[model samples]
Target: MSDFAIGLCGIGAMFVLMILRMPVGMAMLAVGYFGTVILNGTRSANALLLTETFSSASNYSLTVIPLFVLMGNIASAAGFSSRLYEAAFAWVGWLRGGLASASIVGCAAFSAVSGSSVATAVTIGRVALPEMKRFGYSDALSTGAVAAGGTLGFLIPPSTGFVIYAILTEESIGQLFMAGILPGLLLTAFFMGAIAFVTLRNPGAGPRGEFVPFEERFKALLRAMPLLLVIVVSIGGIYLGIFTPVEAAGVGAGMVALMAGISGNMNREQAVKAVSDTVRTTAMLYLIIIGASVLNPFLALTELPATLGETMTAAGFGPYGLLFLIVLAYLALGMFMDGLAMLVVTIPIFFPIVTAAGFDPIWFGVIAVIVIEMGMITPPVGLNVFVVKSVAEDVSMGTIFRGVLPFWFAMAACLLVIVVFPQIALLIPQAMFR
Candidate 1:
């Protein structure tokens, strides 16, 4: 009878649909749409649907999604990801536990261009896993590194999840992007350190190697010049006020396309595949946005966020405690849900509470993304695990699970770092916006 009752029941039904193996977006769209219609009657729902669809489809901020995705797809197809790995591997592959550390660095570089966990895991796994196996790396370290490293795709720039967060919260997309850079690099470092420690403790997981010849390493590094150049220009341009976020996205896509075309890597077939993938991914994102549109009215009507915020604030939790709870909830839900779908459903509810708790929107956006990274490696439905699983077929599921455990801990450490010193997350935005 009440709004909360309908909402809770609708969410419950959504879980049932998920258990039945319905697509997440479709289930949410169906449940949220039908629930809105029930709560507001058919007439209001239909009218709002028409209005919301038109406006949401044409929204300027929403356009950032397709551009970022296009940039990622083009960069990937152009062979930029491989170049990044080559450089990272040549330099780091000689260290103690070198190959595994190289994979983390490679994944971080690839994540700079491709924004999805699936793409990151698959791309790097295709390139790095075989090499790690060849180098006598343990399946645990090899598979685990790729899986955990793939989660970086969401943390690095051009991140689709970060873009979606901006759209949902109506935060500045530019600020959201700048917020990701430091944290992304820090997490990558954490993964590398964890790999080194594991290898050092038990050299069986990895093998130390002679340094790569400076000449060969430099040559290999040269192979990544295009990728490095593009990343530097795109992210730097955005940060320095030289380009808006949307414009920066466009430039990145164009650069990727040019590089792919010049290098003869992107044939007509590859181009088609890239476009098709981009279109499909873009459509799915927009549909989720539309589904949120259907629920937006209900969000307003419920007043649930206000009540919940008051409830939390009154229970003697400060901003930090409330933040801890929100992050924890994200971690738990991530176990079974897709990251994007989880964001779509939960953000509408908790984002308000987060803002009420006196956090900056830009800072909170970074924190939310870091939390999602933990999900991508968590068991059951961790998308990164699936990516590696699909690529490294000989690896059992347990190996991949064990592999990600350290990275998960590293992700937790990254979170703690961000929580303790908000400046790590806030500095870039403050320096830019101020």
Candidate 2:
């Protein structure tokens, strides 16, 4: 059989393994190794496996994943996430649907520290959901806000999605992080507008929160200062060229560890657990990266990406048109696939197509991350939605899904804004580096 035909069969077999509930990394690795053996020889496949595993594991950029994950776990242990929620609540809780808005703001703040969307949702929802419920906020609005806000973890600085994308596409992690900033903030605003729209349609859905005295508000803000400082120095330092992304991750983790120790929030046991979690998460990421590396050469042998790109070009699908189709496919994939897995599996194919069509790789990274965010809150496989349901146990999955619908549109709106004006994603990176 032709190499291209072999590649097609390999992809189909990989999906079959995935459907049988095999781990994503394992499925890819198995398919890739055997596919290479078929196309080349067993000797070549063996060498590729060893080299890919060692090289991907030893890469310096991979360190950022564990460090950032540690920073988040430490911060969560220290109750910094709760402090963030309190500060946001103190400022915005008095408005209509303000508690939900506060949750989004708190999630955004924590996103700067925590890179995982499910972690952000669970952390903030633990603090905000009970408070909103006590204040008579509807389950739909409250859960919806938390689910939507959690997606910011994928878009904001320190994002694991950005890290993985950077590693995959060989783009600058810092540039991708900067590209996400304005779009993240823009999506936050759009989510807030969604809350307002919901409350206006049903005022009882979200009642105004109690007014806080200025003194109390200031005190709340003061309490959250340590977290704010960590976020700024870590992320802002990267933008300012004071530190690389890896350095920033190390600094953020160390600072959070110190703060957690000082506050007596992260005990020895908690610290140990944080480190263990970091290792596990880092291992999972590395396995996926290694699997992708092994798969890439086999795919290259098939020349499928080049063939597809040429086909599109021949069909007169210019950059924008091709991009539109890619985004649409992502939205559909979001319904069934895990977001990070989707990135790991597809960017190898899509990145070449996108860059070949003259799209900026960094810009495409931001756009892809945002669509992945939509998937996190989209139906069926909306991971953040399930995270919220786990927290708000009495709320049905349907209710949570319904609650998040408006915010999903907010995400779509954000996508439209960035597509029409790509500079929204590009502006900061350009100014900082140019």
Candidate 3:
């Protein structure tokens, strides 16, 4: 059989293993190893495996993953997420759908610290959902806001999604983090707007929050300043060329840990939990990376990317057209597959097509993440929806799905905005880096 056919068969085997409940990383590893042995001999395949494992394990850039994960775990353990919610609520909880809006703001803030959307949703949902329910907010608005807001975790700085994207495409992790800033804020605003629209249509759905006194607001903001400072300093350090992405991750983790210890919030047990969680998450991510690494060499030998690109071009799909198709595929897959899995499995195939079409890799990273965020809330396997449902157990899965519908469109709008004006994603990296 042809190399392309062999590559296709390898991918098919990987999917079959995945469907049979195999881990994504192991499935990829299994297929890639055997496929490489088939295409090349055992000697070459064994050598590739050994070198890839060694290189991936010792990769300096990968140090950022664990550090950032530790920062997020420490932040969660120390109650920084609650302080963020309180600050956001103090400022915005008085508007028509203010509590819901505050939920989005809170999620955005927490996302600045915790780069995982499920963490953002679960963390903020625990705080904001009860408050919204107390104020007679509808389940739909309250749940939807948290679910949608959680997606900001992927777009904001310190994002694991961006880290994985950077590792896959060999793009600058710092530039991708910078690219995420405006788009993250923009999406947050769109979510807030969605809350307003929902509440406007049914004012009773989100009753106004009690007015917080200026003094109280000031106090809340003061309490949240430490969390905000960590975010600003870490991201700002990157933009100013003051810290490499890995260094920034280390600084952020250390700062959050020190603050937690100083405040007496991270006791022996909590500190241990934070460290354990970080290790577990870090291990999972590294496994995925290794799997992708093994799969990448096998795919490169296939030359399938070039063939696919040629086919697309011959079929009259220009850059934009090809991009649309890829985005569409992501939207469809997201309903069933995990976002990280989608990113790792597809980047090897799609990145080449994207670069070959003369599109910007940084810009495309932002766009790809936005679409992935949409998948996080889309029905069936919307990961964020299930996360919210788990936290808000009284709320049915269908209700959470219903709640996230408007926010899904809001995400779509955000995607369109970035696509129409790529500058929104490119502006910061260009201004600061250039």
Candidate 4:
């Protein structure tokens, strides 16, 4: 068979395995392994697999993944999440649909420190779910807000998605991270707006939160100050070159550990658990990266990405047209694959073509992360939705999905804003960094 034909066949077979419920990392590795053997020889394929695995594992950029995840886990264990919610609630919970709005805001705040969608969702899910329930907030609204809001974990700074993309595309990590801030805030605003609209539409949907006096609201600020500092240092520090992204992460980890310890949130046991969780989750992401490495070169040999790009170019589509197609693809895959898997699988194929298409790679990274954010809230396979679902047993999966629809629209709208105004994504990165 021709190389192109083999590549196409390999992709088709990979999807079949994925549909059969094979793990994404394994499916890619399996198809690419055999396909490499067919395209080359067994010896070449074996060497390719082994070398790819080793090189990918040793990549310095990827080290940021675990550090970022560790910072998040440490922060969560240290109880940053609870204080964030408390601060947000005290300030906004008095508004109509305030508690739900507060949940979105709280998640966005937490997303800065905790860049994992599932981490944000599950952490906030545990804290915010009960509060919403106690306040007589409808399960749909409460659960939906958490699921949808958790997606901000990707769109916000300190994103795992940005880390992977920066590594894969060789974009400056700082620039890509800066690119996400405006888009992230816009998304957060849309999420909050969606909640306000929904609860306003049906007054009973979100029960009013007990009013906190202005003094009490002001007092709540002290509890959330640590989070704001982390955001400034982790994100702002990186932006200003006060530290590298990884160094910023180290600072975040240290701050969380100290604060958590000081707050009595962390005992030795909790600290041990935090490390265990970080190591386990980081190992999983690394495994997926290693598996993708095994597959990418084999796939690269087929020249499928160039072929696809040429076809798109021949079809005479504009940049916007291609961007729309990419977003649509993410929406479909969001129903099946997890966000990181979707990114790792698709970036090798899409990155080259996207850059060649006159799109900015850093800009593309922001847009791509937002696409993953959408995936985090979409049905069937949204990790965030499941995170909230797992915690709120009384809320059915379908009901949660139904509720997140508004936030989904909100996500889409934010995406549109970014598409129309590349300046929104690029401005901060350029103005501050340049």
Candidate 5:
């Protein structure tokens, strides 16, 4: 069989393994390894595997993953995440659908630290869901809000999505992080607007929160300052060029660890648990990266990306048409695939096509992350929805799915705005890097 045909078969086998409950990393690795052995010799495949594994594991930039993850794990263990939610609630919970809106704001804030959608959803959802429930908010609206809001974790600074995208495309992590800031804030606002629209349509779905006194609100903000400061310093330092992404992550992690120790909010056991979790999460991410590293060269050997790019160009689609197709494909894949897995798998195929069409790579990263965020809340396989369901066990999956629909539209709207005015994603990065 032709090498391109073998590559297609390899992809199909990877999906089959994934369907059979094999881990995504292992699936990619197995497929890539065997595919390479078929196209090259066993010696070459073994060498590729060993070299990529070490290189990916030892990648200096990737240290940012573990450090930022440790920062988030420490924040959660120390109750800093809860404080962030409280601050958001105190300020915004008095509005219509205020609790839900606060959840969105909290997700955005924690996302700067956590960088994982699942972590953001769990941290904020655990805090916000119960309060929304107590306030007599509809389960659909409450659960949906948290699930959809959690997607911000993938778009905000310190985003794992951007980090992986940077590694895959060889783009600057700092530039991508800066590109995400404005788009992330824009999406957060759009989510809040969604909550308003929902509450307006069904007053009972989200009752107005009792007014918080200004003093109390200020105090809540003060309590949340530790995390806010970490976020500002780490993410802000990147924009100011005072720290590379790696240094920013280290500083953020150290600051959080110091605060946790001094504040006595994280006990020894909690600290240990935080470290363990960070290691586990980091390992999983590293494995995925290694798998991608192996698979990318195999794909290149098969000439799949080049062939796909040529086919796309020959199809006579304009730049926007190609982009629209890519977006639609992402949306469809989002229904069934994990966001990160989808990112790793599709980027090799899509990135070349996107860049070749004269689209800005940084802007496309923002757009890609946003679409992946949409998938987090998309039904059937909505990973964020499942995370929310785990938190709100009393709420049905269908109700949560229903809840995310409005926010899903909000996401689509955000995507549209960014596409029309690419500057929304590019402006901050351009200004900072210029």
Candidate 6:
């Protein structure tokens, strides 16, 4: 068979493995290794696997993954995340659908520290959902907000998605992080607007929460200051050139650890649990990165990415038209695939097409992340939806999916606005790096 045909078969096999409930990292690794063996003998395949494994494991920039994960895990175990959610609730809980809106706000704030959609959803949803239910909010609206808001973890600064994209595309992590800020905030606003629309259409769905006195709100905000401060120093220091992303992550992790220790909120047991969780999560990410590293060369050898690029360019759809189609394709894939797996698999194929069409790489990173974020809440395989379901065990999957539907449109609108005004994704990075 032709090399391109082999590549197509390898991809089909990867999907088949995923359907059989195999881990994404292992599926990619297995496909890449065997595909290479088919094309170039066992020696080259073994060498490729070993070299890529070491290269990915030793990548200096990737240290940020473990450090950031530690920071978030420590914060969660220490109750800092709950404090952050409390502050958001105190400030926004009085509005119509206020509890739900507060959940979005909390998700955005926690996302700055966590950088994982599942983490964000679990951290905020655990606290927000019970309160929303107590206040007579519908499960769909309550669950939907948390799931949608959790996606901000992939878009905000310290995002794992941007970090992986940067590694994959050789783009600057700081620049991509900067690019994400405005778009992340923009999507958060759109999500809130979605809540308002839902609550307006059916007042019974979301009731207004109690008015938190100004003094109490101030106190709640004060309690949340530790995390807010860490977020600013870590993410803000990067933009101001005071720290590289790696240094920022290390510093942030140290600060959170100190706070947790001093406050006595993280006991020895909790500390061990936090570190164990960090290691586990970091290992999984490393495996996926290693798998991608192996798969990329195999795909390159196949010349499939190049062939597809040529075919698409020859189709006469200008850059914008091609972009529209790519977005649609991502949306379709999002329905059934894991977001990170989709990202790793598709970037090798699509990045060249996007950059070749004259789109800025950093801007495109932001755009790709937003589309992937949308997938986190998309149906069937909506990862965030599943995370929310795990938290709200009594709530049906259908109810959660129904809840996330409006937010899905909110995501679409956010994507549209960024597409039309590329500046939304580019402005910060340009201003900072200029």
Q: Candidate 4: which stretches are off by over 4 Å?
A: none
Clash totals in order: 0, 0, 0, 0, 0, 0
Candidate 1: residue 189 Cα off by (Å): 0.7
Worst 10 residues of 4 by lDDT: 60-69
Hey, what RMSD does candidate 3 come out at?
1.1
TM, every model = 0.97, 0.98, 0.98, 0.97, 0.99, 0.99
lDDT of 4 by residue, 1-434 (tens): 78888889988898899889887788888988898999889999999888888888888777777777888888888787888999999999988889988888888899898878888888888888898888888889999999998888887878888887876777888888888888888888998899888987998889789999999988898878987888888888888889888888888887877778787977888789999999988887777777777778878899887888788777877777887888888889888788988898889988877887888888889888888888887878878888888899888999999989999999888888888888999998898777
Question: How well does model 5 score by local distance difference test?
Answer: 0.94
User: Per-residue lDDT tens digits of candidate 1, residues 1-434?
Assistant: 88877777777888889789887767776776677688778887788878888888989877767877888888778778887888888898888788888888988888877778788888888988898888788998999999998888888887888888887888888888888999998999999989978997889899865578989899998989887888888889999999887888788888889889888988898899999999999998888788777665665666655666778889887888998888889999999988888887888888888888788888888888888889988888888888888898899898899988988998999899998899998899899989
Q: Write the per-residue lDDT of candidate 6 for residues 1-434, one digit (tens) a residue.
A: 99999999999999999999998999999999999999999999999999999999999999999999999999999999999989999999999999999999999999999989899999999999999999999999999999999999999989999999999999899999989899999999999999999999999899999999999999999999989999999999999999999999999999999999899998999999999999999999998999899999999999999999999999999999889989998999999998899999999999999999999999889889999999999888999999999999999999999999999999999999998999998988888989
Instruction: Please provide, for model 5 over 73-100, each residue's C-alpha lDDT reduced to its tens digit, 9 standing for 90 to 100.
Output: 9999999999999999999999989999
Angstrom error at residue 41, model 6: 1.1
| Global lDDT of each candidate | 0.84, 0.92, 0.91, 0.85, 0.94, 0.94
> Model 5 TM-score?
0.99
Segments of candidate 2 deviating more than 4 angstroms: none
C-alpha positional error of residue 88 in candidate 2 after TM-score superposition, expressed in Å? 0.2
Model 3 TM-score (2 dp): 0.98
Better of 1 and 5 by lDDT: 5
What's the C-alpha lDDT at position 122 in model 5?
96
Q: How far is candidate 6 from the true structure (C-alpha RMSD, Å)?
A: 0.7
TM match of model 4 to true structure:
0.97
